[model samples]
Target: MTHPDTRRPSSLTAKLAGLACLLTLAPLQANDRLGPINITAAREAPAIAPAMPETVITREEIERSQARSITDLLAGRAGLTVSNEGGPGKLSSVSIWGQSANRTAVFLDGVRIGSVSAGQSYLEHIPLEQIERIEIVRGPRSGQWGADAGGGVIQIFTREGTEDGSHLSGGIGAGSRSQREADAHIGARQGAFDYSLGVAHRETDGFDACENGGPYTPPCYADEPDNDGYQRDSLQLQAGYRFGEGGHVRVHVLAASAEVEYDGPTNNSEIEQRTIGLSASTGRIGFWQLRTRAGRHIDDQDYFRDRHFDSRFDTQRDTLSLANDFFLGPSTTLTLGADQTDDKLSSTTDYVEDARRNRGLFAQINTRLGERLDVQAALRRDFNEQFGTANTGSLDLAYRLDDAWTLTAGHGTSFNVPSFNLLYYPPYCIVPGLCFATANPDLEPERTRTSRAGVTWTRGPWAIEATAFRSSADDLISSPPPSYVPENVSEATIRGAELAAGWTTDKWSARTSLTYLSTESEATGEPLPKQPRWSGRLTVDRQLGAFSLGTTLRGRSGSENDNQGYVVADLRGSYRVAPDWRIEARVDNVFDRDYEVVDGFYQAPRGVFVSLRYGR
Candidate 1:
C-alpha cells in the first residue's frame, strides 16, 4: 500500500481547524415538527409491526439537501461506504456491512439496473430530480431478491404523476472546479394514462494530480499530465397505461453517457448505456397477481491508449412472475409465487457469448402469534442454468414491548453467481513477465448467512434506534495470487452496530447517527480493503419565516489499509423567493478534506454551488 499526495488548498486546513468554532457559533434553533418516517414505496402490504431500525429520505429531503448526485445522498447513511474512481460523473461504488460493491444489488422499480457484464452499478447517472423516494433495506435479502442480495438492497422509485396537476420543474447550477449541472423534469396524468420525462447533465474538473510513490509502487498519486476530468449526461422517460380496473402496463427507458479521465496506465475512457423495459401487471383472478417484464441494455466502452480498443456489451432479460395469496383465517395468511428469468449477453471483445436462464418458486406464511407478537417465514428454491441450484430462506419476528419500545429480529441466507468479467476476462501482464490476471470458468457461487436484532424507542417528538448485526459469508469470491478469476475463499465475516436518533420540534429538526464495523478475511487474516471502522454524521435544519438553513457534519475513521481518516462539513440555505420558486445555495466539503475514498483515486476539493428551482 502507498500514500498518495492529495493536493488541497491551505484554506481547507484552516476550515478543519475551525470546526469546533463553527459548531458552537452556529445558532441552535428550535426543532421543526415532522411526521413519522414511512415506507409506502415497498410492495409488501403495510403492517403495524414493531418499530425497526430504519431511515427514510423523502423527496422533500432530497430537495432540501441539494445533493449533487445520488451518491451524495447515500454517502453518510449508516453502515455504508462509498468509493469513487474519478470526479462527480466518474465510476463510483458502494458497500454495506463490509460486503464489496458487487455484492449489493441496486433496483429501479424492482428492475435490476447494474451491468450484468461487469457486475457493477453506476450511481452517478441516476437523476435525483426524477426520484420519488429511496428505500434502503439493510441486511440480507437473499430469500426475496436471490443473487447479489448478500449485502443489502437499494430500491429507487421514480416519480409518478399524481392527481394534483401537471407539473414541470428544472434547475441549473455551477460550482467550484468548473463543476456544472442542468436538470429538468415534466410529468402529467390524464384519465387513464400517466407519463414523465427527465434529463440531466453534469461536468467537473476534479482535483489536482498525485503520483504513486511507495514500496508497492502502486499508482497512488493523483497528478497526471493529461487528467482532464469527467462529464455525464442522462435522459429518462416513463409511461403507464391503466385498463378497466385490474390491469396496467408500464414502459421505461433510460440512456446515459459518461467520460472519465484516469491518471494511470489507462487513458481516458468513455462509457455509454441504454436501457428499455416493459412491464405489465394484472389482477383478474381472485387473490392472484401476474407480472411480466422484458428489458434490454446496451453498454459501450472506448479506451484511449496506444492503439484504440473499443468494446460493446449488450444484454437482454425477460421475466415472468405469478403470485397467489390465500387468507386461511383472520390471523393467518399464505403467499405462493413462481418466477422465471431468461438472460443473454453479447460482446464484441472475443469473449464468450453467454445465455442463462433461472427459475424459482417461493412461499411465505405470515401469522400473528398473539396480540403483541408477529412472525413471518419465507423460503425459495432457484435453479440456474449456469450455477446449478440454490436454496434460500428467511425468518422475521417482531415483538411490541410497550407503547414506546419494540424489538425485532431477522435471519436469512443468500447466494451470488460470478459475473461475466470475473470468469471470462483475459489475463494481462502487469510488470513485463509477471502476469497479474487469471480466469476460472468453474467458480462456485458465493453464499452468506445474515442475522440482525434491534430495538426501537419512540417517546414524544423523539425517536431512537439501535441495531446489532453479524454476517458470515462462505465461498467468498476473490482473486487470490495472480488469478484474475474469482476463487472461493474459505470465509469472511462482518459485524457491526448502528445507532440513530432524531428530534423534531416546531420549527427545527436534528438527526445523528453512529456506526462501527469490523470486517476481516478469515483466510488471509487481513482487514477488508476500503472499509472504515467508524463513521458518524450529524444534520440540523432550521426554518425562520420563508428561509431555511441547514448544516451537516460527516466523518470517517482512517482505514486499516493505507488510507487516511477525513472529515467534511457542508452548509446549505434556501429562500422562498416566490410561491412557486425557490433559491438555494450549497457549500460542500467546507473543510476541503484531502482524502480519498478509494486507495488510488482522486477526490474533489471544496466547492460551492447555487441554483434556482421553480415548479408549477
Candidate 2:
C-alpha cells in the first residue's frame, strides 16, 4: 500500500541539487518592501527573516480567495497537503513535508489547542471568519514550541481592534447543497483598552460522501443513499490593555461547536472546542524584557450510531509559560523560556492512564554580523511523566548574496510522544477467546531531523523563492496489517523541492507554486502511502474600480491510491455596491474534476456560493 523509491540519490547529488537552485533564481538580489513580519519562528520576536521556511496568509489574501474554511485556503500552498474524509466540518488534517497531521502542532493566538488523547488537532472545527492572519513555519520547531512540532507549526491569530472608533460588520451567504451562513462582528478601542467580539453560524445539507453500493463494492450505508450534512457555530472575543511604555496585557477567548453527519453505523458526530488565554508583557527592565502566559483548552466529542448514543471523549489541557529576552549586544539577543502543561482525558472506554504532564525549558540566541549575514540557534529539553525525557535543537543561517538575493539554510530536530490511545488502550479480543492484542506502553517517541536550503530573489513587485528539503525520522510508530500491533520502524525519509513566485502590477497580480516530493521507509524500502509526488497551484486576480475578479487552478498528481493527475479550477468575483456594502460570489471546482483525496471518499462536487456584506 506504500510507494517507495527504488533508487536513492547520492549525498553529493542531494547537496548539488540544492546548490543548483541558485542558477534558476533569475537576477540574484534582495528586496525588503514585500517581506511580512512573522512571530512564530521565535515566539516573541517580529522578524522579517527567520532561518526556517515559512509562509503568511494575510487577511487580504483570505478575503480575496473567499475560502469557506482554513483547509480550503491552505490546501495548495507549498510544502503542505490536506486530506479530508467527507465534506465540510468532517474530519480533516494537514500534513507538512509528507509527515502525518498529528505531528504538526496547531496554535490559536499563540496558545496550543488540540486533543492530548488522540495527539491530533481538529482543523475543521476552526472558523476561517474569525482569523486575522495565519503563520505557517515548515520544518521541525520543537526547540521553541516544546513538543509535537516534528512536521511544523501553524499559528492562527484572531481579529483585534486596531482603531479608536467603534464599528459593526456582518455578512450573510448561501451556497450549493443548501448551505447558509451569517456572521457579525463589533470592535472598538479607547485609551489603553481595546476589545473585539464576533459570532458566526453555518449549516449545510451536503452531498453523498461515499460511493454507491455494488457486488464488487462495499455498501455506502446499510440502508439507503444518504447525504452527509454539517453545521457549526463559532464565537470569539479578545481584549487588550496597554499600560506604561511598551507594556500590555491581553486576553482571548474562542469557542466553536460542530455537528457533522457521515455514512456508516456511526451516522453522525458532534465536536466542541474552547480556548482561553491570558498573557502579559512588561516594559524592558534594564536590558531584559519579560512576558508570561496561562491558557486552557477543552476538546469534547460525541458519537451517535443508528439513532443511538455511542460514546464520548472529552479532554482538557492547562498550560503556563514564562519567557525573557535579553539584549546581549548591539546586534544580538538571547531568549530563555519555560513551559508546563497538563493533559487529562475523560472517555467512555477505559484506559490504563488518563492524565499526563510535561515540563520543558528552552533557550535561543540571535546574532548578526556587520552586513549580509544573520544566524539563530535554539535548544530545548522536555520531561514527560509518561516518556521520561527528550531534547531537541535547531540552527538557521541567512546570507545576502547581493542587493536582491538571499541564501538561507536551516537544520533542526523534533520529537513527538505516542498518543494515549496507542499507548494504553485496553486489549480487544477478535473471537471471544481466540485472539487478542494489548496496547504498547513501552512505545518510544518519534524523532525527526530535517534540513533545508534555498535561494530567494525579491525585487519590486516580483518575488521568487525555491528550496530543497530532506527530513528523516526514526522510531516511526505504525500498526502493520493483520496483527495491527503498534511498533516502531527503523527510519523514514522524506525529500522535496518547493518553488514559489509572486508578481504584482497596478491592476492585476499573480502567484504560482510547484512542489515535488518523495518519501521512503528504510525498514521496508518502500515509499510512504498516500503522498502525492507532485502538486502545483496558480492564482491570478484582477482589480477594476470596485470590482475584483480572480481564478485559481490547483493540480495534484495522485499517489498510490488514485495514481492519476487531476486539476480543479475556482472562480471568484466581488463588487462593492456602495461605501459600506458589497456583493461576492464564487464557483469552486469549475471543471468538476472527479478526484479522490482519500480512497473511496469523493471530493466535494462543483458548488456556487454568493454572499452580501456590510460595514467592513
Off by over 4 Å in 2: 1-34, 46-51, 212-224, 426-439, 561-564
- Weakest 10 consecutive residues, lDDT, candidate 1? 3-12
Residue 532's lDDT in candidate 2: 72
Per-residue lDDT over 374-461 for candidate 2, one digit per residue giving the tens place of the 0 to 100 score: 8888899999998889999998888988878889899999999988877886654322454335357888999999999988777788
What lDDT would each prediction earn against the true structure? 0.67, 0.78
Using lDDT, give the best candidate's number.
2
Which segments of model 1 are wrong by more than 4 Å? 1-53, 209-217, 220-223, 242-247, 284-286, 310-319, 327-333, 429-434, 480-485
In candidate 2, how many Å is residue 254 off?
0.7
Which pairs clash (backbone N, Cα, C closer than 3 Å) in model 2? 3-527, 4-526, 4-527, 29-404, 29-405, 30-403, 30-404, 30-405
Report, for all candidates in order, the number of backbone clashes.
12, 8
Model 2, 612: alpha-carbon shift in Å?
0.2
RMSD of each: 5.4, 5.7
